[model samples]
Target: MTRNTDDDGIVVLGHPRSGTTLLRRLINLHPNISSPPETHLLSACARFLDADMTADGVDMGVLAGLDFSGFSESDVLKELRQFSFGFLQRIAERKGKARWAEKTAFDIFHLKNIEKLCEDHVYYVAIVRHPLDVAVSCTEFCTSMGTYPSTLHEYIKRYPQPIEAFAMSWLETTKALMDLGRKRSSRFIMVRYEDIIEDENEIMNSVFQFVDEEHGCDQAQSIFNSIPEIGFSDHKSLQEKSIHKKSIDRWRSLPSPQVKRLGELLNPLLAELGYDEIENTGEIGTTAARRRYATSLALHAAKTNETDDDTKD
Candidate 1:
C-alpha cells in the first residue's frame, strides 16, 4: 500500500452538478495524486455557520462564546481532518499514487478554515453550473424524496425554504470566491463545468500540467490513464449508453413560467458569469434587482430567529 503525502492535495469546490465529481475522478487517476471521497469538511463548517449548530439548538455565536477555538484546536477536529486525509492517502498509495484530492461543493463556504486545517496550500478548483438547471433538479428531488415544503410559498407559509435557496446560495458562494480570486488570481485556478463536458481533454491536460508544474511532482500519466472511461457505480461498466448520465441538465423541460422565474432570479449572476440563457432565456437587470429585494425580506425573517441571549440584553 502507498502512503501518500499531505502535500500537493487539491480541492474541487462549487455547486452540485458543476462537474466537481467528474474533475476529481479525472485528477485522482494521476499516478502522483490521491483524493478521498467527499469528506465535506467545508460543509461541516458551513453547517456551523449557516445551519443548525448543535443538538441543543444553540446558535453558532453562542458556541463561539463558549470557545469553539478550544474545541477547534483540540485533537478532535485535527484528528478528523488528518484521518480523512490519511485514509485517502493510504488508498492512493496502494494504487501506486502519490498525491490526493478532495471534492466537496459546500467546502467553499469554509475555504479559510480548510486552508488552515491543511496548513499547506491546496489549489481550489471552483466549479459552476447553470442555476436554472440546478434549481429544477433540486426542486424535483424535493418532490421525489417526499420532502416537499408544506406550503406553496416556502418563505412565510412553509419550512426548509425552496430549491431556489440552493440555487441562490450557489450563485452567491461562487461570486464570493470569484471575487476573492479576482484579487488573488495567482492563488486560484478556475475551470468551468462546461469545459469538462465540452472540452474534456484540453481542460484535463491543462489541469494536470498546472498541478505538476505548480507542485513539482513527477510524471503522473499512470494514474491519469486509469480513470474509467465513463464512471458509474463501482460495479458498473463504463460504456456510453450503459453509463448513467441521469445527472445531466433537464431544466429545459420545466414549465415556461417557473423557468422564467428561475432565470429572473439568477440572471445577473449568470450574465456576470458569462452564462447566457439557452434559448435566450432569463431576465435582465430589473429582475436581478428584484432578487436583491426578495433576499432582503428573507434576511429580515432570519433576523427574527435571534434570541434575547443573542441580544445585548
Candidate 2:
C-alpha cells in the first residue's frame, strides 16, 4: 500500500514538565517517524494571523493595505493549509521517514486553529500529569534555572505561586485541550505521566493504537535504555538514564505546608483528572517528612563542606 506520509503528522502537547518531551523522544525512535525539537510552527502562524483572522474568517481589511483582494478568504486559507501540510511533509521526507511528530505545549491553545487548517490529517496526544507533581517539578525547574522567586509572596508578585498557580494552570490548560479532543475523540488521546513511568510499553502501545498502527514495543523499550542528556534547549539536562520511581509522587518530598496547600487547591481538579483526592488532614504527618528533608539537606551541606576542606588540604 502506498503511504500517505503527509497525513501522518502527530502532535504531542501538554504543559511543560508533563513528560511531553520524553514521549516525543520515544516516538521519534520509531524507524518510521522522527521529530525535531518543537518548531512551534502552528502556534506562531496562528499568532501572526491574529485572533480576529481565523481560517474561515480572515478579514482582508486587517492585512493593513496588502493586496488580499486578489484572493478570497477561502483561497488564502486553502493556501495556508497547503503550506502547513507541506512543512510537515518536507521535514519527514528530509529525515527519510514516513511520519513526523511535533511537540510544543504552546500548541495546546491553538489546536482548534491547527485542526481548521490541517483537518483530519493531524493526530493529537495530550500528556497529563498529577497537578501536584507538575507544580513541584515546575517550581524546582524554575529554581534550578535561577528564575523562581524564593518566597511565596515574591513569587506571586512576579509570577503565580507554585503549587496553587501551577496546578490551576495545568487544570485549565488540560481541560481546555481535552474539550477540543472530545469533539474529535478518534484522533486524540490523553496519556498520564504516571502510567508511562509505570509501564512505558503499555502506554506507548496505546498511543500507537490511537494512531491506527501496530505496537512498537521493541522500539519503545530500546529508546528507554539510555536517555541522552538532552536539555530543554540544552541548559536543563536529564542526567539520568533510567526513569526513576522517584519521578512519581514528587510532591511527597515537598514541605508539609506546601503539600497541604496544593492538596487543598488541587483536589477538585485532581479528582477531575482521575487522581485520588488528597486527604485533607492538616499537617498530621508533617514532622517525619520534614525531618527526612532536613536530614537530607544537612547531609548535602556536610558533603559540600567536606569537599571544600579536602580541596584545601
Candidate 3:
C-alpha cells in the first residue's frame, strides 16, 4: 500500500508518571489532533521481530515459515509498518480528526523501531518531570496501589532501595529520549512537566508548532473536559480538570535521608535537565508533608516487607 507521509502522526514518549497523559490530553484538545491512549504497538512489533525463540526454547518459527512461503523479512516488516499507521489513521478518521498522537509509557525504549516504521512521518514529544518527584510518585503507586509490581520487583532486585530504582529508571529513560531529541531535533521536542504547569500557553504553543498543528492554548483550560477512557494512563490526571503545581516539588516532603540518597544518584542528570540540585537538609517538613511521607514509607514496607530504617534521617 502506498503511504502518505504528509499525514503526520505524533508519538509521546516519557517515563511512567512523567505527565505524558496530561500532555496527551492537552494535545487532544486541538481540533485537528486525536491523542489516543497507551497502545504499545511499536514495542509489540519490535519484540516480534527481535524474538528468536519462545519461553520454552522453541524457535518462534514465524519468520522461517514466511521465508518458506516466499516472503522476505523486509516484506513482513513493511506490511507491519503500514498496518501500524493504518490502524492509528483509521481511529483519527473516526474521531473526525486530521492527525493522531499516541502515548505509551514504555514507548521511549522502542524509538529505533518506531523511527524505522514511520521515518519522517512521525513527530516525537518527550515530556519529563523532576526525577525525585517521579521516583516519589512511582514508589507511591507501586507500594500503595500495586501498580507495576513486576517492574518494581525487578528494580528492587537490582538496587538496594526503591527510590534508587525509580530514580535510575527516570535517569535511563530520560537520557535515551534526550539523546534522540538531540539526534532528531527537527522532529523531536522535549517538554518539562513543571514548565507546562507554570506556563501552559507558551509551552503548549511551542508543542503545537513543533507538530505543525494550529495552537489551541485558548482551550487548554478545558482540555480535561473530554479525558480519554484509557485504562492504563495516569488515573489521577483524568480526575484533574486543569493543570496545577500541587505535585511540583513533592519530593521536598520526603524524609531527608531518602532525599539525600536520591540526590546522590540523580544530581548529575538533574543538572543536565536544567532542574535545581536536590538539597537534603535534615529539616522537618509540614505536618501534611510528613504524614504523606510516612504513609508512603508504610506502604512500601508493607508491600515489600522491608524495614523503613533507610527512610529515617
Candidate 4:
C-alpha cells in the first residue's frame, strides 16, 4: 500500500490516569495537529478485521462473508486501512490541520493488532506516570464518578483490592508499550508525566519534534488558557487547566498498609521507569508487628536469591 505523508497520524498510548489526555490536548494546540478525544477507532477497526463467526455467542460472520465474496485477508486489510486513514484525514482536513492523533488509554492493550491495521503510517507517543499515583487516581475517579468504567470495573473484579488492580493495569500497559518502543525505537517515544509537570516547555518541545511537528511554546501554553471538556478523559484536567505538581505524590496520602502493598506490586517497574521507590514504612503497624513483617520480607528475598543462585550453578 502506498503511504501518504499527509495522512500520517499519531497514537497516544498510556494507561488510564497516566496523562495521555493531557498530552493529547497539548498536541492538539499545535496548528498542524488535530487530536480528537478518545475514539478507540484503531482498536475498533482491528476488531472488525479479526471478527469471527462465534464471537460473544453471536454470529459475526462478516469476515467469512468477505472471504466468500473472494476478498483475501490482505484485500480486506487494505480496504480497512484506506477507510481508517480517510476517516482521520477528513477530520484533519476539516480542522485545517495536516495530521491527526488518537488517544484511547485502553488501546495500549491492543497495540499489536492496531499496528497491523495502520501498518507504519502511525507514530506512537506513550505517556506514563508512576503506577502508585495512577492507582490512587483510578480509585479517586471511580469514587467520585459513582461508577467504574469497563476496564477498571473488570480489573476490580479480578483483584482482591482496587489499587492492586490498577497497579497491574499500569504494569501491563506500560510494559507492553515499553517493549514496543524497544522494537520500534525510531517510531516510538515515551513521555513521563512527572517530566511534563516539571518542565512543560522542554518536554513538549521533544514531543512535538517526535511527531515531526514544530514546537510552539506559545501554543502549548494555550492549553491552560482554556480547557475543553473531552469525553472519556480525566475531567480533573478540565477542572484544573494549569499544570502543577500537587498530584505527583498523591499516593503518599494513602495509608501505609496500602502504600506498602503498592510498593510490593510496583517497586521494580517504578525504579525501571526512573521513579523513586515507594517507602513501605510509617504507620503500617505496631513496632513489633512491623519488625516481624520486615523480617519475613527479608527471608523471602533471601530464599528467592538462593533459588536464583542454584539455577546459575
lDDT of each: 0.58, 0.70, 0.78, 0.80
Candidate 3 error regions (>4 Å): 1-7, 52-74, 147-152, 227-231, 280-313
Worst 10 residues of 1 by lDDT: 231-240
Cα-based TM-score, every candidate: 0.60, 0.74, 0.79, 0.81
What would the per-residue lDDT of candidate 4 be over residues 1-313, giving only the tens digit for each residue?
A: 3445844688888888998888989888888888887777887886675654564565355556787889876788778888887777788889998888888777876777787676666788889998888999988888999988786777789886888889888887788888888977877899899999888789989988877777965555577777574566667776775788998988777667777866877888888889888876755457867797899999999999999999999
Top of the candidates by lDDT: 4
Q: Give candidate 4 misplaced runs (Cα > 4 Å).
A: 1-7, 50-69, 227-232, 282-313
The local distance difference test score of model 4 is 0.80
lDDT of 3 at 12: 88
Q: How many residue pairs clash in each candidate?
A: 13, 0, 0, 0
Comparison by TM-score, 1 against 2, better one: 2
The candidate scoring highest on TM-score is: 4
Relative to the true structure, candidate 4 reaches a TM of 0.81
Which tens-of-lDDT digit does each residue in 1-313 have in candidate 2?
A: 2336456788787877788877887787767777767777777666555545458875544232243546655555567767765786688788898788887655765655666665666787789898778778777777777674332234345445666666766766777777868786767788888888888888888888777677764555454475553433322324445555777887777666666766887788678778898876576565887787899999999999999999999
Weakest 10 consecutive residues of candidate 3 by summed lDDT: 304-313
Per-residue error (Å), model 1, residue 215: 14
Rank the models by lDDT, top first: 4, 3, 2, 1
